[model samples]
Target chain A: MRTFEHVNAPDVQTAVALLGEASTEAIAGGTDLLGELKARLRSPQRLVNLKTLAGLQEISYSPKAGLRLGALVTLAEIERHPIIQERFPILAQAAASAATPQLRNMGTIGGNLCQKPRCWYYRNKLFECWLKGGDKCFAEDGENKYHAILGADRCHAVHPSDLAPALIALDATLRVVGPDLDGELSLEELYTKPTESRRQMTILGPGELITDIRVPIPKNGSRGVYLKTMERQSWSFALVSVAAQMNFAGERIADARVVLGGVAAIPWRARDSERILIGQRFSEGLAERAVEAAVAGAQPLRDNEYKVSLAKALVKRVIIDLCSTTD
Target chain B: MATKAVRAKKLKVAIRGPGKTAIKLTVNGETHELLIEPRRTLLNALRKDLGLTGTKKACDEGTCGTCTVLLEGKPIYACMALAIECDGKSVETIESLSKDGQLHPIQRAFIAEDALQCGFCTPGQIMSVKALLDENPNPTLDDVKRVLSGNLCRCGAYPKLFQAALRAADLVRTGR
Candidate 1:
């Protein structure tokens, strides 16, 4: 890792002010940022440590106000919280399926949401992909198995967070704090594609920090499920994952939110699939149709065509599993 | 909103600028003070500065759990953690498990079941298991598998390791 100054911020405002300095980055859990620094992907002059900041480690919940998760809450806490496991099973399942026990204990939820892509090509310092200000994306033509199938224009690297898809499916909102930008935005707004001027995954401005995440209370008759498939049994990134939340009126679906991960630059919200499921009676055949609509416009690369089918299958499985459960 | 008010209080911030800083860490119930660069990892500090070589460092990255240690009683990869960030924090390594030269129950179980082949990953695997068994005395088979997933055993002693973990749980529960 490159040599740099380290400062423990007293609070959020000081943290934001320190990050506004030249070539400075925020360090929360240091699981992803430290790895990036060691790999020479990023060489910041200073690191503003956010672990010392108070009031960002609490996890509170209420039936009226829903769930409020401080940015510094570790993934292990989420996986073990009784309220999350019972009320928001999808989020708990996503947290449990991520990385491993040791990493989960070290990785915070806010850091997990802002994690960089896991593409081998992007991670390697030899090849600077378009996202890294290079000419072309090496994954576009070589070793593109783990690349994205959706929202892949300038970059084909897929988003690696398992929690982001589940949180988006739950309609979570993030409280962001910065020098001039301090407000709440839906979780979906946190992600963006690589545009002409912006070659990043998220639209977070420099010096901005995610303070906390707010998840809305599930409807009276709603339930959610998360399903992920990996190359091995454990400790591997998701090959394809689906998070499905459905509101049912008796035996018919009233509302649905379906999101796919490991198949897009962002957590790909399956609006078409959601549209197909609402107001329809839950059945195996309907799930198949919804899965078809979910993968309608996927443009898979040469080595990732199997992801489309895998994502579709996971979508179907999650929807079916959610419908089969009673509450 | 509440954080804004707290920010206005002008809290004394600990800023370690452009130079080495003195950091105090509590390792294995002993306090140690060291002056080091901010870029130094806790794993290196433990091995070099504190002379605690029981904790192995296989993959410097967070992937391999060979550097597993307990930070505030939660298992975390030491290689991924900065020594400066560990100021005033308690860290328990593999060296702290045994007391008065008597092997810990988990250590005894590992020896009895022959869970280790080459023993390169034994320290890390033992630390992870110790953390799990510390929290959950009666861990299920799935719990053992999930907790040790990060610790890679190239010797492929997973079945024997699993048996040892179960045996350790039984021994601890019965006070054997």
Candidate 2:
């Protein structure tokens, strides 16, 4: 890893100020950042340690206030929290299925949400892909099995977070602190498609830091489920994951949100699928129609055509399972 | 609480240098002061500065659990952690499990069950199991499998390893 100066930020203000320096990055869990540094994908001049900042590790919840998760709360904590498991089961399941027990124990919520793409070409320092300011994406033509099937503008690399899809399904918002910006944005706004003007995945400013995540309270008779398919049983990134949350009025679905991961540059919200399910009676036929609508416009790459079917199957299974559950 | 306040005060003194910084680490109930660059990993500091090589290093990235250790009672990858970030923190390594030359129960179970073949991944596997058993004394088979999934055993001793973990749990319950 390239040598750099390290500073322990005393508070959020200090951490944001330290990040204002050129070529400086914040280190929360260091699980992803350390790997990038070792692979020479990034070489910042300074690292601002966010662990020293107080009060960023708390996880609080209330029936009226919903859930408030600090940026420093580890994935392990989220996976085991009783309130999270009971109130927002999709988040718990997503957290449990991510990485491994050890990595989850150290990786924080903020770091996980802001993690870079896991594209092998982008990760390999030798290949200067388009995301890294090169001519073109190598994965577009070569070894594109794991590339995105949706929202592939300039970069086809898929978003790697298992939690982002679940959080977006639950309508979570993020509170950020920066030199010029300090407010909340919907979880959907945190991500952006890679375009020629903006090559990065998120729209966060240079000195911005995520402080807290607020998940809205689940409505009455609401049910959620998160299902992920991987190459192996454990410790592998999701091949295709589906997060579904449905709010039912009596026996009819009143509202719904379905998001797909590992198939898009951002957490792909299946609005067509959600539209198909709303105000419809929960049934296998409804689930099939929703699943079909979910994968309607997917433009899979040469090697990733199988992902469309896999993603469709996952969405169908998750919707049926969630609809069958009782509140 | 007073001691914690004092330690926080001490850590508040930031290191504003353009080069290596001095920091103090508390590992295995011992405090060691070392000067290292910010990029130095906790795994390297443990092996080189403290000379505690029981923690094996593999994959250096966070993928492999060979560099697993306990940070504040939670198992984490040492290779992915910076030593400077561990200032004023407690770290438990594989070396600290045994006391007074007596093997820890988990170590004894591994030996009895022959859970290891080449033993390259033993320390990490044991540490992960120790962390699990420390929190849940009576873990179910599924719990053991889920927690140990991070520590890979290339020797394909997974069945015996699970058996050893179950045996360790039994021994703990009986106060052996």
Q: Give the number of the best model, judged by DockQ.
A: 1
CAPRI quality band, candidate 1: medium
What TM-score, over all chains together, does every model reach? 0.96, 0.96
**Highest lDDT among the candidates is held by which one?**
1
Which pairs of residues have clashing backbones in candidate 1? none
Candidate 2, residue A35: lDDT: 88
lDDT of 1 by residue, A79-169 (tens): 9999999999999999999999999998999999999999998899998788899879888889999889887898999999999999999
**Which regions in candidate 1 have their CA more than 4 angstroms from the true location?**
B1-12
- What are the chain A TM-scores of the candidates, in order? 0.98, 0.98
TM-score of chain B as predicted in candidate 1: 0.90
Model 2 has a clash total of 0
Residue by residue across B32-64, what tens digits does model 2's lDDT show? 898877878999999998999999998999877
Candidate 2: DockQ? Answer: 0.46
Query: Candidate 1, residue B137: CA error in Å?
Result: 1.4
* Colliding residue pairs in candidate 2: none
